[model samples]
Target: MRPLVLLDVDGVLNPIGRRPPGYRRYRCVVEGVTYVVSLDPRHGRRLLGLAEATGAELVWATTWEEHANDWIAPRIGLPSLPVVAVNADTLPVSGHGEMFKTPAVAAYAGLRPFVWFDDQVWAEDEEYLRVHQGVGDFLLVHVDPAHGLTSDHLGMAKEWLTLTGFSQGS
Candidate 1:
Protein backbone atom coordinates (compact mmCIF):
# COMPACT_ATOMS: atom_id res chain seq x y z
CA MET A 1 0.00 0.00 0.00
CA ARG A 2 1.16 3.54 -0.64
CA PRO A 3 2.28 5.40 2.44
CA LEU A 4 0.14 8.19 3.83
CA VAL A 5 1.07 11.77 4.54
CA LEU A 6 -1.21 13.43 7.06
CA LEU A 7 -1.15 17.18 6.48
CA ASP A 8 -2.12 19.84 8.98
CA VAL A 9 -3.68 22.86 7.30
CA ASP A 10 -3.19 25.84 9.59
CA GLY A 11 0.50 26.03 10.42
CA VAL A 12 2.18 23.41 8.29
CA LEU A 13 0.82 23.89 4.80
CA ASN A 14 -0.52 27.38 5.45
CA PRO A 15 1.73 29.71 7.43
CA ILE A 16 -0.15 31.73 10.01
CA GLY A 17 1.06 35.27 9.32
CA ARG A 18 2.51 35.23 5.79
CA ARG A 19 -0.48 36.02 3.60
CA PRO A 20 -1.73 39.37 2.29
CA PRO A 21 -3.96 41.72 4.29
CA GLY A 22 -7.48 40.73 3.20
CA TYR A 23 -6.56 37.30 1.88
CA ARG A 24 -5.20 36.61 5.34
CA ARG A 25 -8.67 35.92 6.61
CA TYR A 26 -11.04 33.52 4.86
CA ARG A 27 -14.73 33.92 5.55
CA CYS A 28 -17.11 31.06 4.93
CA VAL A 29 -20.61 29.87 5.70
CA VAL A 30 -20.88 26.21 6.57
CA GLU A 31 -24.30 24.73 7.29
CA GLY A 32 -25.57 28.28 7.82
CA VAL A 33 -22.75 29.34 10.12
CA THR A 34 -20.21 31.91 8.94
CA TYR A 35 -16.55 31.89 9.84
CA VAL A 36 -13.33 33.78 8.99
CA VAL A 37 -9.77 32.49 8.61
CA SER A 38 -6.20 33.15 7.42
CA LEU A 39 -3.64 31.04 5.59
CA ASP A 40 -0.37 31.10 3.58
CA PRO A 41 -1.00 30.17 -0.05
CA ARG A 42 2.54 29.89 -1.41
CA HIS A 43 3.82 27.28 1.00
CA GLY A 44 0.56 25.39 0.69
CA ARG A 45 1.18 25.03 -3.03
CA ARG A 46 4.68 23.74 -2.41
CA LEU A 47 3.33 21.17 0.00
CA LEU A 48 0.73 20.00 -2.53
CA GLY A 49 3.45 19.67 -5.16
CA LEU A 50 5.55 17.69 -2.75
CA ALA A 51 2.68 15.30 -2.15
CA GLU A 52 2.23 14.80 -5.90
CA ALA A 53 5.95 14.24 -6.40
CA THR A 54 6.31 11.75 -3.57
CA GLY A 55 3.40 9.48 -4.56
CA ALA A 56 2.03 9.60 -1.06
CA GLU A 57 -1.64 9.73 -0.22
CA LEU A 58 -2.73 12.96 1.47
CA VAL A 59 -5.24 13.12 4.29
CA TRP A 60 -6.31 16.28 6.06
CA ALA A 61 -5.31 16.36 9.71
CA THR A 62 -6.66 19.76 10.49
CA THR A 63 -9.23 21.27 12.83
CA TRP A 64 -10.93 22.98 9.94
CA GLU A 65 -12.04 19.63 8.48
CA GLU A 66 -14.82 20.15 5.88
CA HIS A 67 -14.15 23.86 6.06
CA ALA A 68 -10.58 23.26 4.94
CA ASN A 69 -11.77 21.63 1.74
CA ASP A 70 -14.41 24.26 1.09
CA TRP A 71 -12.33 27.32 2.03
CA ILE A 72 -8.64 26.47 2.24
CA ALA A 73 -7.89 23.83 -0.43
CA PRO A 74 -8.74 25.92 -3.47
CA ARG A 75 -6.66 28.83 -2.25
CA ILE A 76 -3.62 26.59 -1.97
CA GLY A 77 -3.88 25.11 -5.49
CA LEU A 78 -4.96 21.76 -4.12
CA PRO A 79 -8.09 19.85 -5.07
CA SER A 80 -10.05 17.90 -2.51
CA LEU A 81 -8.43 14.88 -0.89
CA PRO A 82 -9.50 12.60 1.94
CA VAL A 83 -9.94 14.40 5.25
CA VAL A 84 -9.99 13.27 8.88
CA ALA A 85 -12.10 15.46 11.09
CA VAL A 86 -11.51 15.60 14.81
CA ASN A 87 -14.32 15.67 17.33
CA ALA A 88 -14.62 19.39 17.89
CA ASP A 89 -16.63 19.24 21.10
CA THR A 90 -14.18 17.14 23.08
CA LEU A 91 -11.71 18.74 25.45
CA PRO A 92 -8.05 18.22 24.63
CA VAL A 93 -5.62 16.38 26.84
CA SER A 94 -4.53 18.75 29.62
CA GLY A 95 -0.89 19.40 28.76
CA HIS A 96 -0.57 17.91 25.30
CA GLY A 97 -3.48 19.54 23.59
CA GLU A 98 -1.61 19.56 20.32
CA MET A 99 -1.32 15.81 20.18
CA PHE A 100 -5.06 15.52 19.57
CA LYS A 101 -4.33 15.21 15.88
CA THR A 102 -2.45 11.98 16.40
CA PRO A 103 -5.47 9.77 16.96
CA ALA A 104 -7.26 11.15 13.94
CA VAL A 105 -4.20 10.59 11.76
CA ALA A 106 -3.73 7.07 13.06
CA ALA A 107 -7.35 6.19 12.38
CA TYR A 108 -7.37 7.73 8.92
CA ALA A 109 -4.31 5.93 7.65
CA GLY A 110 -4.76 2.65 9.47
CA LEU A 111 -1.45 0.72 9.32
CA ARG A 112 0.01 2.52 6.34
CA PRO A 113 3.33 4.26 6.71
CA PHE A 114 2.68 7.96 7.32
CA VAL A 115 4.44 11.25 7.89
CA TRP A 116 2.58 13.84 9.96
CA PHE A 117 3.30 17.50 9.29
CA ASP A 118 2.05 19.84 11.93
CA ASP A 119 3.21 22.62 14.25
CA GLN A 120 1.42 20.92 17.07
CA VAL A 121 2.91 17.74 18.51
CA TRP A 122 3.98 17.24 22.08
CA ALA A 123 5.50 14.82 24.55
CA GLU A 124 2.42 12.66 24.15
CA ASP A 125 3.28 12.28 20.50
CA GLU A 126 6.63 10.81 21.43
CA GLU A 127 4.91 8.45 23.79
CA TYR A 128 2.43 7.45 21.06
CA LEU A 129 5.34 6.69 18.76
CA ARG A 130 7.02 4.59 21.37
CA VAL A 131 3.88 2.62 22.07
CA HIS A 132 3.04 2.05 18.44
CA GLN A 133 6.58 1.32 17.30
CA GLY A 134 5.71 -2.20 16.29
CA VAL A 135 2.49 -1.46 14.46
CA GLY A 136 3.50 0.42 11.30
CA ASP A 137 5.84 3.04 9.92
CA PHE A 138 5.07 6.51 11.29
CA LEU A 139 7.08 9.70 11.36
CA LEU A 140 6.21 12.93 13.15
CA VAL A 141 7.49 16.01 11.33
CA HIS A 142 7.44 19.42 12.92
CA VAL A 143 7.21 22.32 10.48
CA ASP A 144 8.32 25.71 11.75
CA PRO A 145 6.45 28.85 10.76
CA ALA A 146 9.71 30.69 10.04
CA HIS A 147 11.40 28.10 7.80
CA GLY A 148 8.52 26.05 6.35
CA LEU A 149 9.65 22.53 5.65
CA THR A 150 13.38 22.60 6.27
CA SER A 151 15.96 20.32 4.71
CA ASP A 152 16.18 18.39 7.95
CA HIS A 153 12.49 17.60 7.91
CA LEU A 154 12.58 16.57 4.27
CA GLY A 155 15.69 14.53 4.87
CA MET A 156 14.08 12.74 7.73
CA ALA A 157 11.05 11.97 5.56
CA LYS A 158 13.27 10.80 2.72
CA GLU A 159 15.26 8.67 5.12
CA TRP A 160 12.12 7.06 6.43
CA LEU A 161 11.02 6.17 2.92
CA THR A 162 14.48 4.91 1.98
CA LEU A 163 14.78 2.84 5.11
CA THR A 164 11.43 1.31 4.32
CA GLY A 165 12.73 0.43 0.82
CA PHE A 166 10.23 2.55 -1.02
CA SER A 167 11.68 3.63 -4.33
CA GLN A 168 11.18 7.10 -5.76
CA GLY A 169 11.40 8.38 -9.28
CA SER A 170 14.09 11.04 -9.66
Candidate 2:
Protein backbone atom coordinates (compact mmCIF):
# COMPACT_ATOMS: atom_id res chain seq x y z
CA MET A 1 0.00 0.00 0.00
CA ARG A 2 1.18 3.51 -0.77
CA PRO A 3 1.77 5.88 2.15
CA LEU A 4 0.91 9.55 2.28
CA VAL A 5 3.41 12.11 3.47
CA LEU A 6 1.82 15.21 4.97
CA LEU A 7 4.09 18.23 4.53
CA ASP A 8 4.08 21.23 6.84
CA VAL A 9 5.15 24.66 5.57
CA ASP A 10 6.21 27.10 8.26
CA GLY A 11 8.88 25.28 10.22
CA VAL A 12 9.37 22.37 7.88
CA LEU A 13 9.84 23.67 4.36
CA ASN A 14 10.20 27.37 4.89
CA PRO A 15 12.27 28.30 7.88
CA ILE A 16 12.56 31.81 9.36
CA GLY A 17 16.11 32.05 8.02
CA ARG A 18 18.43 31.29 5.10
CA ARG A 19 19.76 27.88 3.96
CA PRO A 20 22.78 25.65 4.64
CA PRO A 21 26.08 27.33 5.52
CA GLY A 22 24.39 30.62 6.32
CA TYR A 23 21.61 29.36 8.56
CA ARG A 24 20.39 32.28 10.63
CA ARG A 25 17.18 33.21 12.39
CA TYR A 26 14.97 36.12 11.41
CA ARG A 27 11.61 37.47 12.55
CA CYS A 28 8.71 37.90 10.19
CA VAL A 29 5.35 39.55 10.75
CA VAL A 30 2.59 37.44 9.26
CA GLU A 31 -1.10 38.38 9.47
CA GLY A 32 -0.67 40.32 12.74
CA VAL A 33 1.61 38.26 14.94
CA THR A 34 5.37 38.13 14.50
CA TYR A 35 6.89 34.69 14.07
CA VAL A 36 10.50 33.51 14.31
CA VAL A 37 11.31 31.27 11.33
CA SER A 38 14.31 29.38 9.77
CA LEU A 39 14.11 26.49 7.23
CA ASP A 40 16.68 24.94 4.91
CA PRO A 41 15.90 25.00 1.20
CA ARG A 42 18.34 22.16 0.61
CA HIS A 43 16.49 19.91 2.98
CA GLY A 44 13.24 20.78 1.29
CA ARG A 45 14.68 19.66 -2.06
CA ARG A 46 16.02 16.50 -0.51
CA LEU A 47 12.58 15.73 0.88
CA LEU A 48 10.95 16.29 -2.48
CA GLY A 49 13.43 13.93 -4.10
CA LEU A 50 12.85 11.39 -1.39
CA ALA A 51 9.11 11.58 -1.91
CA GLU A 52 9.53 11.05 -5.64
CA ALA A 53 11.97 8.19 -5.09
CA THR A 54 9.74 6.50 -2.50
CA GLY A 55 6.40 6.84 -4.26
CA ALA A 56 4.82 8.47 -1.21
CA GLU A 57 1.89 10.71 -1.92
CA LEU A 58 2.48 14.28 -0.76
CA VAL A 59 -0.29 16.22 0.94
CA TRP A 60 -0.17 19.73 2.27
CA ALA A 61 -0.77 19.70 6.03
CA THR A 62 -0.02 23.33 6.77
CA THR A 63 -2.14 26.29 7.84
CA TRP A 64 -1.06 27.91 4.58
CA GLU A 65 -3.49 25.58 2.82
CA GLU A 66 -3.54 26.08 -0.96
CA HIS A 67 -1.04 28.83 -0.65
CA ALA A 68 1.50 26.13 0.03
CA ASN A 69 1.07 25.01 -3.55
CA ASP A 70 1.71 28.48 -4.91
CA TRP A 71 4.49 29.61 -2.60
CA ILE A 72 6.24 26.55 -1.19
CA ALA A 73 6.07 23.75 -3.77
CA PRO A 74 8.07 25.64 -6.37
CA ARG A 75 11.09 26.03 -4.13
CA ILE A 76 11.15 22.32 -3.46
CA GLY A 77 10.62 21.36 -7.14
CA LEU A 78 7.34 19.55 -6.37
CA PRO A 79 4.20 20.16 -8.35
CA SER A 80 0.78 20.66 -6.81
CA LEU A 81 -0.14 17.86 -4.43
CA PRO A 82 -3.33 17.26 -2.46
CA VAL A 83 -4.09 19.49 0.50
CA VAL A 84 -5.82 19.00 3.88
CA ALA A 85 -7.34 22.29 4.83
CA VAL A 86 -8.04 23.33 8.41
CA ASN A 87 -11.58 22.87 9.66
CA ALA A 88 -12.95 26.18 10.89
CA ASP A 89 -16.22 24.63 12.02
CA THR A 90 -14.70 23.40 15.26
CA LEU A 91 -14.19 26.42 17.47
CA PRO A 92 -11.49 26.57 20.10
CA VAL A 93 -12.48 27.50 23.62
CA SER A 94 -9.09 28.11 25.16
CA GLY A 95 -5.61 29.30 24.18
CA HIS A 96 -5.28 28.10 20.56
CA GLY A 97 -7.59 25.23 19.74
CA GLU A 98 -6.59 22.12 17.82
CA MET A 99 -6.93 22.09 14.06
CA PHE A 100 -7.14 18.39 13.44
CA LYS A 101 -6.19 17.86 9.83
CA THR A 102 -6.22 14.12 10.42
CA PRO A 103 -9.83 13.75 9.35
CA ALA A 104 -9.16 15.45 6.05
CA VAL A 105 -5.96 13.49 5.61
CA ALA A 106 -7.68 10.24 6.47
CA ALA A 107 -10.34 10.95 3.93
CA TYR A 108 -7.77 11.64 1.25
CA ALA A 109 -5.58 8.69 2.17
CA GLY A 110 -8.35 6.14 2.44
CA LEU A 111 -6.77 3.03 3.99
CA ARG A 112 -3.18 4.02 3.28
CA PRO A 113 -0.59 4.71 5.94
CA PHE A 114 0.40 8.37 6.27
CA VAL A 115 3.26 10.34 7.73
CA TRP A 116 2.42 13.77 9.14
CA PHE A 117 5.15 16.42 9.15
CA ASP A 118 4.06 19.26 11.32
CA ASP A 119 4.99 21.33 14.35
CA GLN A 120 1.43 21.47 15.71
CA VAL A 121 0.16 17.97 16.46
CA TRP A 122 -1.13 17.93 20.04
CA ALA A 123 -3.32 15.84 22.35
CA GLU A 124 -5.94 15.47 19.65
CA ASP A 125 -3.42 13.84 17.33
CA GLU A 126 -2.37 11.35 19.97
CA GLU A 127 -6.01 10.49 20.63
CA TYR A 128 -6.80 10.11 16.95
CA LEU A 129 -3.80 7.89 16.34
CA ARG A 130 -4.78 5.76 19.30
CA VAL A 131 -8.34 5.22 18.10
CA HIS A 132 -7.53 4.57 14.44
CA GLN A 133 -4.58 2.33 14.99
CA GLY A 134 -5.67 -0.33 12.55
CA VAL A 135 -7.78 1.55 10.03
CA GLY A 136 -4.89 3.66 8.73
CA ASP A 137 -1.38 3.94 10.02
CA PHE A 138 -0.04 7.41 10.91
CA LEU A 139 3.46 8.56 11.63
CA LEU A 140 4.07 11.90 13.30
CA VAL A 141 7.34 13.44 12.16
CA HIS A 142 8.68 16.52 13.90
CA VAL A 143 11.18 18.72 12.05
CA ASP A 144 13.57 20.96 13.87
CA PRO A 145 13.60 24.70 13.17
CA ALA A 146 17.38 24.91 13.10
CA HIS A 147 18.03 21.74 11.14
CA GLY A 148 15.62 20.83 8.35
CA LEU A 149 14.94 17.11 7.79
CA THR A 150 17.41 15.16 9.85
CA SER A 151 18.87 11.75 9.00
CA ASP A 152 16.70 10.15 11.67
CA HIS A 153 13.52 11.56 10.14
CA LEU A 154 14.42 10.44 6.61
CA GLY A 155 15.52 7.07 7.95
CA MET A 156 12.14 6.60 9.58
CA ALA A 157 10.35 7.36 6.33
CA LYS A 158 12.62 5.04 4.38
CA GLU A 159 12.02 2.26 6.84
CA TRP A 160 8.26 2.72 6.67
CA LEU A 161 8.23 2.62 2.89
CA THR A 162 10.33 -0.52 2.78
CA LEU A 163 8.30 -2.29 5.43
CA THR A 164 5.06 -1.55 3.59
CA GLY A 165 6.40 -2.96 0.31
CA PHE A 166 6.11 0.33 -1.55
CA SER A 167 8.35 0.95 -4.53
CA GLN A 168 10.05 4.17 -5.62
CA GLY A 169 8.23 4.10 -8.94
CA SER A 170 5.04 5.98 -8.45
Candidate 3:
Protein backbone atom coordinates (compact mmCIF):
# COMPACT_ATOMS: atom_id res chain seq x y z
CA MET A 1 0.00 0.00 0.00
CA ARG A 2 1.10 3.56 -0.64
CA PRO A 3 1.89 5.88 2.22
CA LEU A 4 -0.71 8.34 3.44
CA VAL A 5 -0.09 12.09 3.45
CA LEU A 6 -1.91 13.73 6.34
CA LEU A 7 -2.44 17.41 5.60
CA ASP A 8 -3.14 20.19 8.06
CA VAL A 9 -4.93 23.44 7.30
CA ASP A 10 -3.68 26.27 9.45
CA GLY A 11 0.12 26.36 9.60
CA VAL A 12 0.53 23.88 6.82
CA LEU A 13 -1.59 25.14 3.94
CA ASN A 14 -2.64 28.40 5.61
CA PRO A 15 -0.31 30.73 7.50
CA ILE A 16 -1.07 33.47 9.95
CA GLY A 17 0.14 37.12 9.79
CA ARG A 18 1.42 38.90 6.73
CA ARG A 19 1.05 36.99 3.50
CA PRO A 20 4.17 35.50 1.98
CA PRO A 21 5.47 36.35 -1.49
CA GLY A 22 3.80 33.51 -3.35
CA TYR A 23 0.53 33.57 -1.45
CA ARG A 24 -2.70 35.34 -2.26
CA ARG A 25 -5.24 36.49 0.26
CA TYR A 26 -8.80 35.32 -0.29
CA ARG A 27 -11.85 36.50 1.59
CA CYS A 28 -14.82 34.26 2.17
CA VAL A 29 -17.92 34.42 4.28
CA VAL A 30 -18.77 31.36 6.32
CA GLU A 31 -21.90 31.59 8.45
CA GLY A 32 -22.12 35.35 7.98
CA VAL A 33 -18.60 35.88 9.30
CA THR A 34 -16.02 37.17 6.89
CA TYR A 35 -12.69 35.41 7.06
CA VAL A 36 -9.63 35.94 4.97
CA VAL A 37 -7.43 32.98 4.21
CA SER A 38 -4.00 33.29 2.69
CA LEU A 39 -3.07 30.50 0.38
CA ASP A 40 -0.50 29.63 -2.28
CA PRO A 41 -1.96 28.21 -5.46
CA ARG A 42 1.31 26.52 -6.18
CA HIS A 43 1.04 24.56 -2.97
CA GLY A 44 -1.99 22.61 -4.17
CA ARG A 45 -0.27 21.78 -7.42
CA ARG A 46 2.92 20.83 -5.65
CA LEU A 47 1.04 18.67 -3.16
CA LEU A 48 -0.75 16.91 -5.98
CA GLY A 49 2.54 16.40 -7.76
CA LEU A 50 4.11 15.02 -4.63
CA ALA A 51 1.26 12.53 -4.18
CA GLU A 52 1.63 11.39 -7.76
CA ALA A 53 5.37 11.07 -7.47
CA THR A 54 5.23 9.23 -4.17
CA GLY A 55 1.97 7.35 -4.71
CA ALA A 56 0.70 8.63 -1.39
CA GLU A 57 -2.93 9.27 -0.56
CA LEU A 58 -3.58 12.82 0.60
CA VAL A 59 -5.96 13.14 3.55
CA TRP A 60 -7.34 16.03 5.56
CA ALA A 61 -5.88 16.03 9.05
CA THR A 62 -7.05 19.49 10.08
CA THR A 63 -9.73 20.90 12.35
CA TRP A 64 -11.39 22.14 9.23
CA GLU A 65 -12.43 18.56 8.52
CA GLU A 66 -15.04 18.40 5.79
CA HIS A 67 -15.07 22.17 5.63
CA ALA A 68 -11.70 21.93 3.91
CA ASN A 69 -13.47 20.33 0.98
CA ASP A 70 -16.26 22.90 1.13
CA TRP A 71 -14.01 25.94 1.29
CA ILE A 72 -10.20 25.69 1.32
CA ALA A 73 -9.70 23.03 -1.35
CA PRO A 74 -11.39 25.03 -4.08
CA ARG A 75 -9.33 28.09 -3.29
CA ILE A 76 -6.10 26.16 -3.56
CA GLY A 77 -7.25 23.87 -6.37
CA LEU A 78 -7.19 20.61 -4.45
CA PRO A 79 -9.57 17.73 -4.78
CA SER A 80 -11.60 16.53 -1.83
CA LEU A 81 -9.80 13.98 0.31
CA PRO A 82 -10.53 11.70 3.25
CA VAL A 83 -10.79 13.43 6.61
CA VAL A 84 -9.30 12.21 9.87
CA ALA A 85 -11.91 12.88 12.52
CA VAL A 86 -10.52 14.13 15.83
CA ASN A 87 -12.32 14.93 19.04
CA ALA A 88 -10.64 17.18 21.59
CA ASP A 89 -12.29 15.49 24.58
CA THR A 90 -10.84 12.14 23.70
CA LEU A 91 -7.36 13.50 23.04
CA PRO A 92 -4.59 11.89 25.04
CA VAL A 93 -2.55 14.19 27.25
CA SER A 94 0.93 12.79 27.83
CA GLY A 95 2.09 15.73 29.98
CA HIS A 96 5.07 15.88 27.66
CA GLY A 97 3.73 18.79 25.65
CA GLU A 98 2.82 16.45 22.86
CA MET A 99 0.09 17.79 20.64
CA PHE A 100 -3.42 16.65 21.51
CA LYS A 101 -3.86 15.53 17.94
CA THR A 102 -0.90 13.18 18.14
CA PRO A 103 -2.79 10.15 19.31
CA ALA A 104 -5.64 10.75 16.92
CA VAL A 105 -3.23 11.14 14.06
CA ALA A 106 -1.47 7.96 15.03
CA ALA A 107 -4.75 6.11 15.30
CA TYR A 108 -5.86 7.31 11.92
CA ALA A 109 -2.60 6.15 10.43
CA GLY A 110 -2.99 2.77 12.12
CA LEU A 111 -0.18 0.54 10.79
CA ARG A 112 -0.04 2.32 7.47
CA PRO A 113 3.02 4.37 6.61
CA PHE A 114 2.18 8.07 6.60
CA VAL A 115 3.61 11.55 6.31
CA TRP A 116 2.15 14.07 8.75
CA PHE A 117 2.28 17.80 8.14
CA ASP A 118 1.47 20.12 11.00
CA ASP A 119 2.90 23.13 12.84
CA GLN A 120 2.24 22.13 16.44
CA VAL A 121 4.00 18.75 16.45
CA TRP A 122 6.80 18.79 19.04
CA ALA A 123 9.52 16.61 20.49
CA GLU A 124 7.11 14.61 22.60
CA ASP A 125 5.16 13.66 19.52
CA GLU A 126 8.40 12.60 17.90
CA GLU A 127 9.17 10.38 20.89
CA TYR A 128 5.74 8.81 20.65
CA LEU A 129 6.30 8.12 16.99
CA ARG A 130 9.65 6.55 17.74
CA VAL A 131 8.28 4.31 20.45
CA HIS A 132 4.93 3.43 18.92
CA GLN A 133 4.83 4.00 15.20
CA GLY A 134 8.41 2.97 14.56
CA VAL A 135 7.47 -0.27 12.91
CA GLY A 136 6.84 1.40 9.55
CA ASP A 137 8.07 4.33 7.51
CA PHE A 138 6.60 7.57 8.85
CA LEU A 139 7.66 11.16 8.36
CA LEU A 140 6.40 13.98 10.53
CA VAL A 141 7.02 17.38 9.02
CA HIS A 142 6.61 20.54 11.04
CA VAL A 143 5.66 23.43 8.87
CA ASP A 144 6.17 26.98 10.20
CA PRO A 145 2.81 28.50 11.11
CA ALA A 146 4.02 31.93 10.11
CA HIS A 147 5.16 30.77 6.67
CA GLY A 148 2.88 27.81 5.94
CA LEU A 149 3.99 25.07 3.58
CA THR A 150 6.89 25.81 1.23
CA SER A 151 8.54 24.27 -1.74
CA ASP A 152 11.52 23.28 0.39
CA HIS A 153 9.25 21.33 2.72
CA LEU A 154 7.65 19.60 -0.23
CA GLY A 155 11.07 18.77 -1.61
CA MET A 156 12.14 17.31 1.69
CA ALA A 157 9.04 15.12 1.82
CA LYS A 158 9.74 13.95 -1.71
CA GLU A 159 13.34 13.24 -0.82
CA TRP A 160 12.33 11.29 2.27
CA LEU A 161 9.84 9.29 0.23
CA THR A 162 12.57 8.50 -2.27
CA LEU A 163 15.16 7.67 0.36
CA THR A 164 12.76 5.32 2.10
CA GLY A 165 12.04 3.58 -1.21
CA PHE A 166 8.31 4.13 -0.70
CA SER A 167 7.14 4.04 -4.26
CA GLN A 168 3.85 3.12 -5.95
CA GLY A 169 2.38 -0.25 -4.93
CA SER A 170 4.80 -0.62 -2.07
Highest TM-score: give the candidate number: 3
In order of listing, the candidates' clash counts read 1, 5, 0
lDDT computed for candidate 3: 0.83
Q: Which candidate number would show the highest lDDT if scored against the true structure?
A: 3
User: Could you report the Cα RMSD, in angstroms, for every candidate shown?
Assistant: 3.8, 4.5, 2.1
Model 1 root-mean-square deviation: 3.8
Candidate 2 Cα RMSD (Å): 4.5
Question: Where does the lowest 10-residue lDDT sum fall in candidate 1?
Answer: 89-98
- Candidate 1 ranges beyond 4 A from true positions: 17-25, 29-38, 90-98, 145-156, 167-170
Regions of model 3 farther than 4 Å from truth: 30-33, 133-135
Clashing pairs in 2: 15-38, 15-39, 16-37, 16-38, 17-38
lDDT of each: 0.66, 0.65, 0.83
Worst 10 residues of 3 by lDDT: 128-137
Evaluation by TM-score, superior candidate among 1 and 3:
3
Q: Encode model 2's per-residue lDDT on 1-170: one tens digit a residue.
A: 86788888776666534554534444555456675545444555667766777888778877767866766666556788788765446522223333456555555666777777776666766566556535476677777754555668877876777676664563
Native-to-model Cα distance after best TM-score fit, residue 62 in candidate 2, in Å: 0.8
TM-score of 1: 0.73
Residues 1-170, candidate 1: write the lDDT tens digits: 67777777666655566654324566778779886555556545665555666667777888878777788788766788788767556734435433766656655666677888778776687576556534367788888854454447766775676567542433
Task: State the lDDT at 4 in candidate 3.
Answer: 87
- lDDT for model 2 comes to 0.65
